[model samples]
Target: MSFSITLVIIIITALISWRAFQDNDLKYKMMFYPYNVKHHKEGYRFLSYMVVHADLMHLFFNMFVLYNFGQVMEYMLDFKYGSSLGTFHYLILYIAGGLFATLWPMSKNADNPNYLSLGASGAVSSVFFAYILWNPGATLNLIILPFWDIPAWLLGIAYLAYEYFMAKKGTSNIGHDAHFGGAVFGILYVLLINFEKGQAFISYIFN
Candidate 1:
């Protein structure tokens, strides 16, 4: 399928979210399917939640990052892991990252019934983080700062650090906890799974 298909799917999510918010149905909360008698009958809407976004800006940024990183990762993993394993891994990380994002926040605020969030930023960040791990010395220019230059791996580290502090202090409106948790899971999961393969990568470089 073309990437535009993914874009279209995301746009549909934005429209639904907008309409739901306008209608003032509290049932429209996008993060976890809030436990309700009706939703309970449906069961496990976690995967569906990945496609939903709170607004236009939210949808754009998530799709932008996914478009940039996901296609390349998808191709590489397809070759390395075979099409089936590759697709499975991609799905695993994508869903796991979002699920973890929600879990990390909810873990601390389990009793805070008002807490709600939605977006694919945390999951896309995982893909971006993993890409950097596999391509360690690649360069990534900071678009916001423009003049800043850094190695891809280092950039990922810096992002994780910022997320850590922000999450710790409850400093901003952004979901820094999701960012940090997803990144950690990405780096650790890739390294742990490919430990032998990674050592071989190093040995080939030296030899």
Candidate 2:
């Protein structure tokens, strides 16, 4: 149903992101740095980085996506997994999703002291993919492109493809690589844990 946990996360992230906007030192402290995690023992950045965003736009976009998809995923999980386990697992899905999303980058760029990243894009991507998996036919109207009510599955494929294209160009500041990885985790995590339910969803979507 209308879940509380996702709202709670939005509130916390908003507060942190807002405060970080006013304080550059705080922003730097909360940002994820692979080098710092390995050498300086700043492991907590894995979680902290999700709360502190680069700007209001970044925070708004992420929380907006999470609000739409996370609530759906939560309600669906409640039906199959029960509310208690569903909420608990949702929390794990988010926090662990954020943590796990960083592993690939950390491993690849651990030596680069200047490399830093932040925001909830990784975990939010996971939630978005989960919603896409559970409801392929449902449509989403992007705020910027409200006229195009694209099906979630097509949107997902395009989203990943766009991320891959952007990652190759390296022109945008967005972490497209993490977004891609997080999306993969989102789809796999749900199917891996609930293969029968996933199968049911797939069957319903196609038939």
Candidate 3:
């Protein structure tokens, strides 16, 4: 059987998040603290923050989304680029997505020592948005409105708009900037690798 990178990432993230839940100091160190990154040279937090979470729900939601969308993305990439190169791109999409997601927050909060964020939502968003590109016609149901099946492309648009609005509002503790950034990165990364997919996605939306 071929190894599953998506499963491996979930397991690793779950274990680390579970342990961090029991250790405050560990979570603190793993969190993305922009000021610390700027002043204390703790650049590792860009990636480390993804292994920790604010709570069980946060971890579960991120991992659950990743598990579903990531598997599809993995298969699609492997089919298009072969297993080895595909796996490399998947890792780049995920890790770089997480790193890119923090760019806005890092720039905005670099001077504020109290700013801290943690979770894999950014990376997971990358996976989810990439899946949407491949399956724009797929139906998506929100947890709050389970009965209303939304088209994947529509959901992606709504998700991005909400994140942008919330990020601009800057009133919530949630990392809206990361979600927005990761999603955009996901779309662009897939388009960059497979320009034809972007054309197909546009056609799917219009016709």
Candidate 4:
């Protein structure tokens, strides 16, 4: 059997990101520098940024989460809708989430030539939340803090809240806007694909 789409994505991203770490020019080309979009018109940076990460840990964390959530979501999609459409939809949801998330930062930071953001956090968040849409009761425990078992929906709410607050503060270097945008885009994608699933999600929590 062919390797799953999730694994393929992870492998490609890892290889490029590792090389990007060593090549300054590659990293500069991959980074989402608003200056490039605003003036020089290097719009490809929007999607290229997703494949390059800041460091080993950053790549590992994002790819690990993508592996966990993306595999399951793709499996569900393939099972529910047939193989071809499933793979295509999975591809769309991921790349679209990343592509869609880029617009906001580009528009907001068009004038700030110094502003640069790079990482797959936004795309990873989309995959993470897409899985949550199906299994809201799912819970996660950080490896370092196994005692803290948090429900997915609660964590999702907390995540959005934190991102929103941080985006407003604009103090941290973190791309909270991208995080939030990816998350919302994921949820919306799931809803668009299957509205009944969302209704069930709402009913599952409240009832």
Candidate 5:
């Protein structure tokens, strides 16, 4: 979970996305090969696609948020099982969230030729979700309303609501579906881990 490595990934993604934006013929495709749905094609695109961002702004925002949340997650994960496990878990969650994010877009726009998505927002959201699960009652300071305090879970809920609202509105360029899908997957992932270990904290929260 090196911030430098994360930054490098963002830089690479921005380059690819810029190249694609310049040349339509070179537009990057994810799990769906040739960007076609009927092909039913699947591979490591999920892991690779997270390395592509739509633009500089997109890359900046995603990586900024990721670094902000990731530092804590990386440290805790590392402390839990050394630095290697932290890296491994982070990679898995990032890839899994990206794959799930791609699924929603591909399913809804199965026949869309004008739809091409690229960003690490989904993967970042996964990190945010994981952080919340790990630090359930952590204090979250608000940026806009500086005086008000917010809980991590409430912040997540607010994010989900905003994404769902924007998705329904359908006017934003942001990938709201990806955000929702990633958040959902992240929460479920935490629950699954808890279930496997018979953790009481999860039962208290869900119950």
Candidate 6:
């Protein structure tokens, strides 16, 4: 059987998040607190935050997305670049997506000592977007309305628009900024790694 890095990540994240749920200190230490990241040298939170979640639902959603999209991404990468290099790129996409997702929040909330964020939403968003880029014609059903299947590219556009709007509105606790940032990173990363794929993606969407 082929090795599955996505499953490994989900297992590790689930274990850590489960333990953190019972330990406030662990959660706090692992959460993405921009204030501490700026004031103190707790830069590890940038990556560590992906391993914890505010609740079971949050963990399940992020991991579920990661599990579905991430496996697809892994297979695509391996098919394109072979096993070793593909795994490396997958790691880069996930880790860098998480790191990139924190940039805007870190800058905007650095002074707000109460600001806190957690979960693998950013990383999962990256994988989801990357999947859309490669499979633009694929049908994606809304979780709430699963019967209505939307084209992957159209869903991507709506998702980005909603995230941008929500981030600007700043009324919700959800990290819309991170979602947008991670998605952008995903698309850009895929394009950079394979410019030909970008051309194919455009043609698939338009023609």
Give per-model TM-scores.
0.78, 0.91, 0.97, 0.96, 0.78, 0.97
Q: How do the residues 68-184 of candidate 1 rate in per-residue lDDT, one tens digit apiece?
A: 777777777777898777777777776687666666775665555454555677777877777777776577777797887777766776788989999999857677887787787
Q: Which digits, one per residue and each the tens of the lDDT, describe model 5 over residues 94-134?
A: 67877787778777776676665667788888878877877
39-145: candidate 2 lDDT, tens digit per residue: 99998888899999998999999999899888878888788888898887788778777877787778867998978899999999888887788776788888799
User: For candidate 6, lDDT tens digit of each residue in 76-118?
Assistant: 9999999999999999999999999999999899999988999
The residue-by-residue lDDT of candidate 3 on 1-207, one tens digit each, is 188899999999999999999999999999999999999999999999999998999998999899888988998889888999999999999999999899999999999988899999888998889999978789988899989998999989999999999999999999999999999889989899988889999998888
lDDT of each: 0.66, 0.85, 0.92, 0.88, 0.69, 0.93
Model 6 quality (TM-score): 0.97
**Clash count in backbone of candidate 5:** 0
Comparison by lDDT, 1 against 4, better one = 4
Clashes of 4: 0
Clashes of each: 0, 0, 0, 0, 0, 0
- Whole-model lDDT for model 3 versus the true structure? 0.92
Residue pairs clashing, model 6: none
Model 4 misplaced stretches (Cα beyond 4 Å): none
> Per-residue alpha-carbon lDDT of model 4 for 139-199, expressed as tens digits?
8887888899888888898999999899878899988988988998899999999888899
Show the lowest summed lDDT stretch of 10 residues, model 4.
99-108
Off by over 4 Å in 6: none
For each candidate in turn, give its C-alpha RMSD to the true structure in angstroms: 4.2, 2.0, 1.1, 1.2, 3.7, 1.0
Candidate 5: regions farther than 4 A off: 1-48, 195-207
TM-score for model 2?
0.91
